[model samples]
Target: MKKAKTISLNVGIALALFAVFLVPAASATTVSIGSTIVGEGETGVVSLMVNDVTDLGGVHVNLTYDASVVNVTALTNSDFDSKPNLYKRGHGWVLLEGGQYESGLSGSVKLCDVTLEAVGKAGESSYLNLTDIDIETFTYPPTDIPIDEVINGTFTIKPVTPSAKVVINEFEQNPPGDDSGNEWIELYNNDSTSVNIGGWKLINSGGKVVTIPDDTVIAVHGYWVANWTNGSLEDSNEYITLYNATGTEIDNTLTAADGNNDERCWARYPNGIDTDSDNDWKYQTSTMGETNGVPVAPVDTTPPTTNVTAPPTLWPGKPDETTIPSGTPLPWTSEPVQLWFFRTDNSDSGTGVAYTNLSLASESVADLVNVTISNNTWTWETNLSKGKNTTVPGTVGEYFNVTISEECNATIEYYSVDKNETPRVEPKKNLTVRIRFEIPFSEVTPGTRYTANVTHDLIEPANEGKDATIVFFAETATIDSKPYYVLDINKSVGGTEMYVGINETAENFTMKRLVMKNKTGKIMDLTFNPEYTMLNYPLWVGKTWTSTINVSGTVTYANNTTIPINIITTEIEAKVTGEENLTTPYGELRCLVVETNAGILDTGLSKPITITAKYWISADEKAMIPKYQSYINGNLTEELVLK
Candidate 1:
C-alpha cells in the first residue's frame, strides 16, 4: 500500500509540472516615437505612442536629435489625465515622464505630444533617437513592464513656398468727393510671421510715388492703409504698384478705368487673394480697413454727352471764319493747334464722366492729273503767187516769192496746171529753204514767218487761165513751245471742266502743264520739271521702257496752312506684252497691251505706295490713247473704259 501511494504522488507531481509548461508567456508592449514632416520656420507636433499595451500606469521616454535641425518647444500629455514633466537639454535632447494616479492606460495610447520647431534649412533631416524608454503596470509600487520595441523617428525639414506673402488688397481711386484727399490704397501681409515693409514704395499710374516710413512692421495677416495725403490718385485710368525695400516688384494691381460711379471702389473680392489679373478684383463700396462688401450694379448706365471746339477756319486768301463744315479738310500745319472738349453727365445726380476718349485719324488724297486727246485734224491749203516776187497772188509769171506762216511743220507741193510739163526751181534758193527747215519741229516758235522763192516755166498764152498751184500740208501744231499732234477739245477732271494738252514727238509723249479752275474761281497750276512720259511710241510686242517723275509744289489748305509737297514716283518696269482688239465707243480698234509697275513716295505720307497699272493703248492716233485702263493699289482695284 505504501509503494502505490508513492507512485500516485510522483504521477501527480509530474502532471502538475507538465501543465505549468503548456501555458504561454505574456507579450511585451511597444513604445515608439512618431515621425513627422515640418516646414522651415514652422512648428510641428510629435507623439510618444504606446502600442499593444495593457494596464499601463507610468511612462518615461528620452529622445535625442541633431541640434542644428530642430528644437523642442513644449511638451503636453495626450492620453494621461495629468500633464507630463518635460526636461529639455539644450536643443539636442529631451526627456518626458508621465503617470496616471487612477486606472492605468490600455493598448494603443499616446503618452504625450512633443512640440518641435524646424530651425534648419530645407532638405535637412534630424533623427529622433529613442535612447531610453520605460513603462510600468498599474500596481501599488509601479511594477516595471518589459518594453521589447523602441521605434525611432525622424524630422524632415522642408521648404515653405508661398505664392506671395504681401499683396495689394484694395484701393479707392474714385471717391464721393475730391479725389485729391479721398483716395486710399491698402496692403496686406499673408505670411505666418510679422513682416517689415520699411523703405517700400507705392506708385500710381500718374507718376506719383510714395515711400513707406522707416521701422514699419506689419503683423501676420495684417493690413496697412495709405491715405491720399501721401500721394495723389487719378479718378480714372489708374493703377498702383508695390515694391520691396530692394526695389523688387512684389505686387501690382490691374489698370482700373472709369467705373463711371464715384461711390464704388476697386478691391480684391476675397481679401488678400492674388491671381495677378483683373478677374481677381471687384468694384464695390469703400471697405477701408475692413472686409470688402458684395459687388453692386452701377447706378448710371448712359454715357456722358460731349461737345468739341475746333480751331478757327481760315482758308488761304480768304477771310477767317468761326466754324468749318464737317468733312472739310484740315490742314497739317507747323504750329500746334488746340481743341477743347466738354463732357456732362445725362443726369445731374448720376455718376459724372470720369474721362473722355479722343481718337484722331488722318486721310489724304493725292493730286491726280490726266491728259487725253479730243481731236486730231490734218489741214491742207492751196495758194498761188505769180509774176513779181511779192507776198500776194497775181497773174502767171516765171519767178514768185511767197510768205508761208504755220504753227507746225508744213510741206509745200507746187505743180504746173498743165500735166505735160515738169516744174523746176533755182538750186541756190532751194538749198537756202531746205537749210532753214532743219530746225527741230518742237523748237519752231509759233507765229513765225518764212519767205519761200519759187521758179516755174512760163505758162503758154492758151493756158493763161491756168495758174501754178501751190499746196501746203500741216501735220501738227505748236502751243507754248510744245508740239501737239492732237488738241484738247472737251476736257474735264472729277466732272469739272478743265484743259489738259498733250505734247509729243515721234519717240514719246509727255505732259507739260495742267490748269484747273475751281468753283470759287481759284486757279491751280501744276508744271512738271522733267515732263512725265506717258508712252514710248512705236508700240510693238515685247517692248519695254522706264521713266521717273517728281512732283514738287505747295498746296494751301482750308485752314490757311500751306504745306510743301514733294512726291517721287519711280517706275520699276513698263512693258508692252502683246496686242489685242477691243470694242470701244469710238470703234473696234487694235490695241497694244501695256503693263507698268511703279512706287510712289510722298513726304506727307507715312509709307510708300505701289501701283500696278494695265492699259490697252491705241497706237494708230499717235496720241497713245487707252481704250481700257486699270489701276491697282494694294488690295483696291479700279477700272476705266472709254465712253
Candidate 2:
C-alpha cells in the first residue's frame, strides 16, 4: 500500500506522491531553506536544512527565486562541503547534488547553502522558493527510501539609506542619423547623495516593459544615461513609466507626439527640469548627458515656383488708334503712341478711336493700355526702371485695374460642317450582312424538326463568327411543353426572307433530320422533305457507319414559279478515325475526329455534288456537338472550316 503525504501550507510545498509514494506521513522529511533579512546591496546566505529524518545517503536540491529583486549570486555546500557534490547557477535557479554517502546522513543535516544579494529597491521582499528535492536516506544506504516535503523561504530587503533626487532628464526618441548607439535615456541626479536604480521597469505605451539591470546608478549632481535593454524608444507617440522593485509607480512621461522632430528631441531647458508639459519641453538639439541648448532646425532647402505671362498687342480694325492716358515719362518714351480703344466701335462712338481724347479716360498718349481678359488681363505703363530688364520697369498712377491672373486660359470655339449629315460614319446601306444562328442545339424542343445554320463561324481563321445551315428533329416534348432539341437560322441583316423547310429539332440525341429550301419564298410541304441524317452514335474511335438521305423537295424561284418535286437519295459514309486535343475560345476539349463522305448516290440527281469533311465532335456526353468542321469545295480550290 502507498502512503499519503501531508503538504505544509506555510512552506508552500506540493508534490504528487504517485505509485512510488511516501512510506508514511509520520516519516515525511521536512526539508527547508530558512528565511532571513538583509540590507539593500548586502549579500546573505540561506542554509538548506532537513528535519524528522533518521538517515540520508544522497540529496538533490532545486531552488528558485526572483532574479530581479534578489539575485542568487552564488551557492555552496559549506555544511555538506566534505561530501562529493556539484552545483550550478541560472536566471533564478540553483541546483545542488551529492551522492554515495555509504554511512548515510541523519536528521538535521544541512544539504546546501545558497548566497543571495539584495540588489533591488529598498523595502521589497523576495521569495527563495524550494521548488523540488529528492533524497535517498537510510542507515544501510537503501535506494528505496525518499524524502517527501520541502519548505521555501523569503528575503526581506530592509531600507538602508534615503534615495537620491534623480529625474529622467532627456530622452532621444527620434535620434539623428544612425540610432545604433544613440537611442538613450539620461537620468539626472540633483541631490548630493548617490542612488542605485536597480530592478527598475521602463515601460512604454505599448505595455512593453524592460528592466534596468542591477547596480545601475547615478552619482551626486551627475547623470546616468543608458541605452534601452529591450527596444529603442519609438518615433511615434510614446508614454513611458518607471517602477521600482515593489511595483511602485515612480515616475512617468505622458504620451507625447514624438515623430515630427527633424533629427532633434524633446528636452527641458534646465537639464533636469522634469515638469510634464508641452511648455516644459521643446524640440531641441539633442544633448547626451549634458546641458541642453535652444532648438535650431536645419535650413529650409525647398525651392519656389514662378509663373509669368505676356500677351500680344491688340490693334484697332477700322481706324488709326492713338493713346490718351498719361503717366510719368520714363524709358521708352520715344515710342509711337497707341490708344486703348475701350469704347464701342460703331454703336456708341462715331470715330473708331482717337488717343488724344483724355475725356474718354485715356488722358495722354504715353500711358495707353487695353487688357484682353478672356480669362487673363495685363496692363502696360512706363514710369521708371529699377533694373534693365522686362520685369523691373516701374509704373505709377492711372493704371489699368486688371484682376485676372497670368495663368488663366482662353478656349476658342470652332465648328466644322458635316460633309455627310449622318449620326455616325456608317454606310448609307448595310455594309455587311450577318446570317445568325437563331437557336442553339441545347434550346431545341422535343417531338419537332428544325433547320438552321449550325456553323456560326464559316470565315477564314475559322474561329471567327459566320454562318452555316443545320436541321433538327425533336423526338418528343421534354420540358415545359417544349421539344428536346432545336435549330434555327435567322439572317442578321438585309435578307428579305428565307424559306423554311424543317424548322424544329431532333427527337432525341441519337437521331436527326434536316431539310433545306432552295431559295427565299420557296414552299416546302411535308412531301417536299430534304432528308438529312446527322450522326451515328454508340461510337468510339474507329467506329464507322453509312447512312442514306432520301429528300424530295420542290424548286422555287423569285418570280413565284415552282417545279414538280423529285425524290433524290444521298448516301454518306462516316468513320470515327481518331481522337485529338483541341483548344477553342471556350476552353480545351478532347474531341473525336470523324471523316465523312456524302454525295448523290445511285438513285440520286444527274449532277451530283460530293463533299468530304472532317468533323471534330466534343467528347463530353452533355455537349455532343461538333466544335469544328473542315472540308474542301467541289472544285477543291478553296478550303472551308466552321467553328
Best by TM-score: 1
Off by over 4 Å in 2: 1-28, 74-77, 81-86, 138-141, 144-148, 160-643
Candidate 1, 92-199: lDDT as tens digits: 555666778889889798877888899889878777766446788878887888778888888998865664488888888777767777778888888888889999
What lDDT score is found at residue 408 in candidate 1? 17
Please state the error at residue 167 of candidate 2 in Å: 17
Candidate lDDT values, in order: 0.54, 0.47
Q: How close is candidate 1 to the true structure, as a TM-score?
A: 0.23
- Encode model 2's per-residue lDDT on 381-496: one tens digit a residue: 32211111111100111121222122211111111111111211111110010111111233233223222233322222242243442333332323223333434332332111
Query: How does model 2 fare in lDDT?
Result: 0.47
lDDT score, candidate 2, position 329: 23
* Cα RMSD, each candidate: 43.5, 37.7
